[model samples]
Structure formats: C-alpha cells, structure tokens
Target: MNKKLKNLVKESYNNGQLDQETVVYIAARLSRKDLKHYISLLKQEEAKHEVLVTSAEKLSSEDVGKIQKLYPGMNVIHSVDKSMINGVRIVENNKEYEINLNRTFHDIIGFLSTHD
Candidate 1:
C-alpha cells in the first residue's frame, strides 16, 4: 500500500481504538494481494491479546502450598460470596463442605427436643 494509507492504518492501530485483528481486517479489505500477510499478523496479535479479558483472583504462595499438600488433585477456581462472613465454604467434586465461624451467632440445633 501507499505511505498515506499505511500511516492511517498504523495510527488507528496504535491509538488502541481498533485492535490488531480489526486493523488487519481492514488491511485485508484494502490489500487483496497481501491478505495473507495481514491474516498472519492478525493471528499473532489475537493470540497475544486472548488473555487480556481473562484474569483470575491472585492466590498467595501459602494458599497454593496448602492446596498442593491437602487437596492433591484439586484445582481451586477462585470465587467469593457476599454472605461468606468470616469463614469459608468449599464445594468440591459435587459435595458441599461448610465451615463457619461460631462468633456472635445463635444456633437452635436440637432446640425442639430439649424445650419440649
């Protein structure tokens, strides 16, 4: 392509408004003879940016060590709950395991039998 068209493309791409894939897509439309070059560039850029929107919560080294030692074959998917309060509840491999803090709380366990 000519210098003017190349400059416009480079500007739009570097501005980050249009990602590399979109830039290459426009390039392909304009440069039918060199579409293969743009396609390869698009694939490379896409691979590099695929993880941009995919991020997980950070886990500390201690946490990872604990998981490796205790859970063996388990891979923890990071998550949170608003009602988690001060403790954790783990649902692993289709089984529910609840661990709760016993502070400033009331439990009516076996109350019916004792009161009657």
Candidate 2:
C-alpha cells in the first residue's frame, strides 16, 4: 500500500507481463498482512474501468455511442431502472452525472418548499 508498491503493481499490470513468477516475486517480499493488502490492490488495479449508464429505458444506439466515445478504453454498461421515469444517469470513476425526471422533480419540490 505504499506508493512504490502501488506503482510497481500498476506498472506490472499495465505492462501485461504479470505472470506467476512476477506474482510470486512480489508476494515473497510481503508479510501476511501486506500480502493481503497487495492482493486487494492487485484486484482493484486489474478491474476494468466501468461506466454505468442507467436509464428508465434502453438508450438509442447514438446515445450509447456518444457515451462510449466519451470514455474510450473503458467498459460501458447499460441497465434499465424504471424508477428513473425518464432520462439518464451516468456513473464513471465513482462520479455520477444525472439528468433525470426524478432528479428534476426533487429539485422542483425542494425549490417550492424553500420559497413557500
């Protein structure tokens, strides 16, 4: 979990040369606690960056394409959530971008309440 170890893991993973020998070489250096932490970090590092596009209904090809273009080299996953009513919510890198009917309604209600 130190910077150097994290960088080494990232570099090894990115290099696509993280074979068994490389794993053992790193594993051999760590204590049990560090080994567990290293494994956790490795799993996180190896996970593909994902973009979750949730909407009330399936999006058009054009919309999906636009999102894909926005996030090249990352996975784009789409899911339907009827409660969204309409519009889309995008999740990328732990950040959320939403423009949806539910959000709009909530905002309107909040504004009306504050002014009332």
Candidate 3:
C-alpha cells in the first residue's frame, strides 16, 4: 500500500473523519488490484488495534469494563477458554500475557526442575 493512501485509509476508518464523498473520490483513483491490496492492509491494521482477552469463562461486564479501561482507545474482545482453568489471558500488540492455573503450574514445574 502507498504510505499516503495507507495513512488516509487508517485515518478514515479509525476516526471517521473522512466524509463519504472523500472516500468515493479516493476509491475512484485506485485500480482494482490496488484496491484489493489496500483492503488487505486495512484488515491487518484493524487487527493490530484489537485487544483479545480470553479466559476460562465469560467475564462479567464489570470485569470487561476494567479490562477496557486498561486498554484505552483500543477495541477489547473477550472470549472463553475452559482449558485456561481460571484467570485471564490477554493478547495485545502481538504479545501474550497469561495468568492462569496452567501457566502457574508450568512455572512451578519449570522452577523445581531447574533447581534440582
């Protein structure tokens, strides 16, 4: 994607500052292949701004709110994973933060094995 077009696309989608007329004007200038590449780039950019929070069970609205507060300006998505066995696993900016029974045990086992 062209840097200028990429920036305009991000700005238009993220802030909704660009009007419909402006979007139509921009789209009119791009070729079919360029448009497809732009759409793919847009999807990748969208994913970067999302926060995926998965836990062993559904989180309460209050809990979700707390997580949302932590990641201001970014979209927060919650999911359930019973294998986590409780606690949360937050994935943001391509990094994983896991705090759960499974992680705890793994840590303990690794520690004991290394110390022996």
Candidate 4:
C-alpha cells in the first residue's frame, strides 16, 4: 500500500501538477509517519544535484570537459552571466564556488573594510 502510494505521488509529481494542497490532502488521508518516510525517500531521489557553471562568456568545450572530469557523474549545465566579470562560478547542490575577478575584488574590499 505504501509502495503504491509512493508511485502515485511520483507519477503526480512527474505530471507537473502535484501542488501543496494535494500533498497535504494526501498526507491527511494517510498515516503521517509513513507519509513522512515516503516523502524523505522521494526527496532523496530528487536530490541528484546538477552542476551549473556560470561565466562571463560562453565556455569552450575544453573548459566544460574539465568540469565534467572534475564532477564525474553529475549533469553539467553551462550559462553565460556577464556579471561575473571574468572567470567562472560552479554551483552544485547548495554550494557555490566562485573563482572570478568580481569575487576577488569583493574579497579585497572586504579585507580592506575589516582592516580599517
């Protein structure tokens, strides 16, 4: 029964209309503890992180290749954001790695402020 419920939830989620109200109603009808457990499993499945590489300009294939080699199995998405100034930023899951001129300038300003 729990397996069937999980499949139903997953199906609804995939179909793109699984709203909070629907989930709340479903949980109200089901055992709260079991529903929570199933939801945790579903979240874990959804937690497959995608790597996003943002830079000031479009990245070359070699740059993307290096990121792929670094992350191995994760999906990589690249986009150009001119605000980065120069260099790249990598975001995976909730963590961000900024290696750019803009970031360096900010760091320097922060250091100067602290020292003053």
Candidate 5:
C-alpha cells in the first residue's frame, strides 16, 4: 500500500498536476503512520536547499539580496543571535561559514595559543 502511494505521488509529481486538491485526496486515503512516512518521502523528493544566516541583528534588505544572489535556488532562513556580537554566520547543508567577531576573536586566541 505504501509502495502504491509512493508510485502515485511520483507519477502525480511527474505529471505536474500534484496540486492541493490532489494532495488532500491522497492524504485522505493514508493512515496516520502512512501519512507521516508519505510526507517525509515527499519532502525528500522536493527538498529545497536551505541557507540559514544567523547574526546579532537583522540583515538589511540589500544584505539579504546579496546573500540570496550568492546562493541561488536555496531557501534562506535568517535569524538573530546576540552572542554573535557582529557579522553573520551562514549554515547550509550542515556546512557552516562563520564570519562573526566572536569567531574571529576565538580564532586569534587559538592561533596565539598554538604559537606560544
């Protein structure tokens, strides 16, 4: 039954007619457990690459636009963290790019420790 539903979802998506009505109809036919599994599978199939930006303050529209341009096709989720101090940290697909003052300070401390 799950396999049948998987195939149906795949076919429907491929046919480009998997709309809200079709989703409601399919969901109505699924058991609670099956619905959860189906939704997870669907998410995997239609997963959008995400870019998460965390900063001490909210980014300006221009800054957000620049970030979006750098990571085209990715869904950006911005958040604020006072601990960041300044600058922003970008996280995408489990990879992190830190450009915050706190991180820089930490890096400098680590470097000095290693040198001394």
Candidate 6:
C-alpha cells in the first residue's frame, strides 16, 4: 500500500472501523502488488458512500479485480447476495452500473448497493 492508502487504513483503524489484523493482512496481501494495493483506496471510498459489504457477501480477490475494472473509481465490498441472478450491485459516484443483461451475471451487488 502507498503512503496515502496506508494512512487512510491507519485512520480507519484509529476510528475503530478497521482492525489491526486486517491491516496486517492487507499489508501482506498487497505486498509487492500495485493494482491489488490500490483496492484499499476503493475500499475506503465504499465506507464514505455508506454502503456496507459485510452482510453475507462473498467477495473474492478475482471479483474485487473485476469490480474495480468495471467501476475503476468505486469501492466494492463483496458478499453472498441471494436476490440477484449473478452480478455486482455498486453504490458509488452517485451513479450505478448499467448492466441490463439477464444471464445471471455475478455483478449484481455492484448495482444493489446503489439502490440501497
């Protein structure tokens, strides 16, 4: 993680939002990583948007990459969503993903987050 991101996580940790173990995990997970490390910024942005991602969503590292790629400026928290067919439901930038397919895409959470 870069200085800015490291600081943000520190701030969140200080605020008691993020835990130390998670911090250590993040540092180790993002070690020697560029794009993966940038996900911290995206995660921080999600907190700002009031969208929670721990209500049963299962976000994988690959899914995180996919969400970041689809909405580069948005932070997505993955969980087990039982409502959508298969896709992300994002709630960021005051706008949502415009996915209109009906093939059970696994990116609905990226959209549901917006509706909420």
In TM-score terms, which candidate is top?
A: 2
TM-score for candidate 2, please give it: 0.73
- How much does each candidate deviate from the true structure in C-alpha RMSD? 14.6, 2.9, 3.1, 7.3, 3.9, 14.1
Q: What would the per-residue lDDT of candidate 1 be over residues 1-116, giving only the tens digit for each residue?
A: 45555454455465444466666557656666556555555454334332211112344668656655656544455455534444555555445565544321434444655686
Model 4: residues >4 Å from true position, as ranges?
1-47
**Alpha carbon lDDT of each predicted model:** 0.49, 0.82, 0.81, 0.78, 0.81, 0.54
Model 3 alpha-carbon drift over 4 Å, by segment: 1-5, 14-36
> Which run of 10 residues does model 3 get worst, by summed lDDT?
11-20
lDDT of 4: 0.78
What's the C-alpha lDDT at position 35 in model 5? 87
TM-score of model 3 relative to the true fold?
0.69
Which has the greatest lDDT?
2
lDDT of 2 by residue, 30-79 (tens): 89988888887776664547788999998899999999999998789999
Candidate 5, residue 105: CA error in Å?
Answer: 3.4
lDDT of 4 by residue, 1-116 (tens): 76777675675463443467666766777687878876875565454447888999998899899999998877799999897799988888778888998879999999999996
TM-score of each: 0.35, 0.73, 0.69, 0.57, 0.62, 0.30
Model 6 worst lDDT run, 10 consecutive residues: 97-106
- 25: Cα error in model 2, Å: 5.0
Q: Pairing residues by index, what is the TM-score of model 1?
A: 0.35
Ranking by lDDT: 2, 3, 5, 4, 6, 1
What residue pairs clash in candidate 5, if any at all? none
- Winner by TM-score between candidate 5 and candidate 3: 3
Model 4 pairs in collision: none
TM-score of 6: 0.30
